[model samples]
Target: MKEKLSRKLAQNVEALKDIFQDSSDLVYRDIQFTESRRGLIVYVEGIINVDLVDQNIISPLIEGLVKAEKPVERLSELPFTRISLTQTSTASDWPGVIEAILTAHVVIFMDDSDEVLTFDVKGGSRRSVQEPSTETVIRGPREGFTESLRINTALLRFKLKTEKLKMKPLIVGKITKTDVVVSYIDGLAKQDLVDSVLDRLKQIDMDGILESGYVEEWIEDNPYSPFPQMQYSERPDTIAAQLLEGKVAIFVDGTPFVLVAPVTLWQLLQSSEDYYERYFVTNFIRWIRLFFLLVALMLPGLYIAVTTYHQDMLPSSLILSIATAREAIPFPAIIEALIMEVSFEALQEAGIRLPKTIGQAVSILGALVIGQAAVQAGIVSAPIVIVVSMTGIASFTLPRFNLATTVRMLRFLIMILAALFGLFGIVVGTVWILVHLTQLKSFGVPYLLGVSPYRLRDFKDIFVRVPMWKMSQRPNSSSETNRNRIGAPKLRGRADEHEGW
Candidate 1:
């Protein structure tokens, strides 16, 4: 329980001093409203707007009281218009007052009154909007989410202007007391999914929620699963698009990455640029990415398996070339593949860890110089180097970093299985992965949505990027009630006729 503000000024001052004893940033000032009426103002030094507090709060109260023919009985009862700031509210207890002050609001205390007035002067330094570093696109909105939570929400609001869009505020951490916002279209989002997400968040009683990833780990359907059940993006257009499809977006203060839940594998693979560009171009790109996705996951393991246990599968010319390359090398196919894969992964990590200029140089040279040296020294075969380099390049095409990382990890695991049982091992591992995916759920939606327990309608935007004219319904993974996103006919108009607005 918190102590209530006293009717006496000196007592309240002593209590405030005890509470903010060692805090040097707390600013407390006493002002005389009239010859008889006294008051105090409290705020933090850097956070609160000093000029606004002075002009709207202090100057008006002192000047208005002096100009009045009769003195006011209490500060709260003051009849002057500019005496206190607009959007001002009263706090009767110390906790409320302190909370207001901590959140960058200015608090005014009257000597004879038991209530304190809090003015919303939350002006401090913050980052301006800039282009996203992670999720880049050529033809969509260039603006991205900043570290500021309010700015991020403002970016979303700028894209979507509708009363149906609702943001429910939540406080997650006990010590950090970080602000979290759950945003979704009120009618489109399923009530049960929203309720489950809120309940999971409320149950998180921890010291801190430093990043949105923290909440993500806790609320995700399967913590141990390598697959990313929830998708995170720094683009407002992405988040806005998800909200329109009835997905809930979770925004954590101090992190630019926002978490979008009830995500499917198809959603993870798709990019915002797909919707922004021409349909044919996007479709072609999607096919290319899909092909590379397979190469990233299966290329290394398949090479090892076929060369080791099923060499007859390859053509005679290719076999002769692979045999000639391995003639000088001592290591088997599995060991050769493992050596190249590990070296490539190390170079990738080094590139990310080093400084920007040097990192790029190192990642490029590290692969070229190291691979060439290894091949010439006969420590590894040339074919293995080519396979590993192609696998690395293919992994880069994945849109989401988390998904790409998952592919890298699973690639190694499948490689090991292939080393043990050859072609059978690859089949076994693939079956196990498929079984796990079929069993997995993100929130309540299936992980392999549109493919497993398949929804045919949801495939409009999946592997093949269908034209927007044909995509009239929202994704089924959202469990949306009103699914008709576009109301007109599938075809826009005839080739020769231009439809008039």
Candidate 2:
């Protein structure tokens, strides 16, 4: 049997030489039986831990007390010193042996033995935990999720510290075999929602999944829509809070940003830090953000409409000032607005792409140079530059970049509409956008939750941040089984006791 198996392996080798041609790490060792007992160890070089394999499996089987006169008996006892064996496999042919070896385990074959012993020896390089750059907060924890799947899950586990936090592993890409984990509180999350997420993930059959963004693109409901259906965050506290609210969270192996499903448009504007601060302060910030969101989306369009067609709408003094600023400009209000908006966007993009040492300098210098040069050349008016600058500042007030970019893009469309039909066109465009938003869903929940659908219960956390004591329940859209977060407060003393005192 041994001789026949070896001959078959030689034949297989002859056929597969081309397939393994450029693989320098592939090892094939041939050994002969002697008084010392000889065998071969085949594995990929860097993937397997060399020291552990040598000290635990290889050294013991070759030079220790388990060295048998018969090779097959010795191979069975080799796993005693190795602590990490989840399973063991015995292969009869070379193809089976090669398959086992490539699956992140070391393969050991002995002379005159038809069986091959495979040792679990998976070890590779990975990054350590560090502060998340994108989601940093002065008052919160500094630890962030890393690219490794195991590390990311461990981060969540460290936060939750409960048995109910369940992680379900999934393999998405056919070629990359990328590992993605869906995590949620078992009893807290909705059953149908979990099933739906799993069903969508299983339907994906792609060649590679490099990042969480790839999974987002594949599983989202409407691929053509500019708005993102799923929310991504680097903060574990944000993910933990969502899980507690009965939402499913997806963590891709090689990305810091974890995806949270069934999120609303209003939820995107909120930051986790909002809930951590005083109610009054948080409410003030929320209102500011809401105001700026509208300003970011409508300022340019409104400016164009007023200057071009609705000049009568402005007060006489204001109109005189704007006219004076525009007297030397050569372009129409629409063209000037477009040029300034596009230039600001370009400067913002350059600031992001450039290195940290140079990014701030480039952004400031570029803005100053462009704004001054445009005004001096009479290509764009000074008032339009001020409006564009205010618009850019307002857009940054939004917490989520996905929503911010959507607002920015729609600004241009609204600008065009305003140029054609004045303020009426802007109103029409706004109504159309509101209609689309009302129809949109994140998972099955409406995007415009508390406002459009008029859920009075959810308003506690919406437009204004209510005090923690007042917030007694989770969002209704979460569909959480354990809905009540807090119980009614009890009075400290009885009325009779107070009267006696």
Candidate 3:
């Protein structure tokens, strides 16, 4: 059952006051066009554009600009141009009126009328577009997504100007009524993948959604998995690139981090700078990233296993020096490594939470001070300190924060395994991780998409990136149809090709 609006303006005002009892921010302004006709304008203070409402809606009505044959038609015959508004319509139900006021829409009540007119005036202060701090690139667009959903979608539209680029909207929370957009290219994206994401979004029923992480947790395929199933970024250029590769982006209101789906382990490791720079430069950097990725995940564990189980593997001089350093130490190799790792993790977390001006200096000075003091006191060996420092540096090289956290967590488990069974335990952990990765799927797509499946086409961008001229086709990340991106690719341009276009 629904309550209908009354024709009497006085009764309607009373009803509205009752509906919004004890709310001091709710405003109700009385308007008198002439002697017999009366009206009421309703809105929430501060959220809407007061000037626009006054200049466009209220000013025209109070003045003699509007013309109507009868009192009933006077409310509908306002002569003014609408700016940044949706289709104006008459709403008759109390529920619609309440919803309109809550969403920054202005409602008008007229005497001797069965309905009222509502106008969309959603506006407020929001952060402007700026450089993304999380995924910074040496070369790329500096503009990033804002907290506004419409503004975020508009940013994407500015990058990709095509009718085929569709952004379908969904309201997730019942109470908050947060807006969400699912953006994708029609031909490039698989229809099934879009439907899969939409279905998951539709099934979400919650009281409120404050951030994109809420939606992410509810919709991800494996909630218990340590690795993030979807990649989130604040850079519009990143989201645009992902869409061009046929991935769907989820844009949540009040959040700048838009999430991209069907991501892989390699994708998390690769930075946006890779695509911006030359093939040779990016390829070398990616190789370095991979090398450090391995070091970050296993350096401490390997050191512990070697010292505890197989000291003969190291050179005579290195083994003798390490043994001399550890002679005065009280803790075992594993304990020493664990202590250093925990201290480093705490410093890293504290540095992030502290103010920016002193955070970096604090982290650096704290690590140096603590490491030197511990070494001098014989609380830990010097070799383990170097190993932990290198591991921390390596973890920072990873592009994705979530993936780096995963590596940090796995490092401890690997250290425990090494302590128990030496190198064999590390090998067992490696095998277990590989099996789990092969089995993990992101929205029905394999976590190790091209690596496990061995796609020859994806290798161009995976291990080593070929020249852009050779990359005429899209990677294995997208659908099979329309795989080719460019018509032809040439290795070199002729000397005569230097003429201006």
2 or 3: which has the higher lDDT? 3
Worst 10 residues of 3 by lDDT: 64-73
Tell me the tens digit of each residue's lDDT in model 3 across 1-501. Answer: 338988888888888888899999898898765578788889999778888888777776555434644444556665444434565667899988888899888988889886888888767677888888898888988888989888899999999999999999998999999889999998888888999999999999999999999999999999999888999999988899899988999999999999999888888988888999999899999999999999999999999999999999999999999999999998889999999999999999989999999998999999999999999998998999999999999999999999999999999999999999999999999999889899999988888877888887776788898877777777676777878987766657576787675
By descending lDDT, how would the candidates be arranged?
A: 1, 3, 2
Top TM-score model: 3
| TM of each candidate vs. truth | 0.93, 0.88, 0.95
Worst 10 residues of 2 by lDDT: 1-10
- Which is superior by TM-score, 2 or 3? 3
Superposed Cα deviation of residue 298, candidate 3 (Å): 0.4
| Candidate 1 TM-score, C-alpha based | 0.93
Provide backbone clash counts, one per model: 0, 0, 0
Off by over 4 Å in 1: 65-72, 78-80, 83-86, 496-501
**Candidate 2 global CA lDDT score:** 0.81
The global C-alpha lDDT for each of the candidates, from Candidate 1 onward, is 0.88, 0.81, 0.88
Candidate 2 structure quality by residue, lDDT tens digits, 1-501: 122244233444453354467888877665434555556667887667778877776555456434554443445654355344556677766567656666567876665556677877756666688887877676777888888777788888888999989999998888776778999888778888888999989988989899999999888877777787999998888898889788899998778899999888888999888978888889899999999999999999999999999899999999999999999888899999999999999999999999999998999899999999999998998899899999999999998889899999999999999999989999999998988888888778888888878887787788997777777787876655687767886444367766866
Q: Against the true structure, what is every candidate's RMSD? A: 2.6, 3.9, 2.4
TM-score of 2: 0.88
> What pairs collide in candidate 1?
none
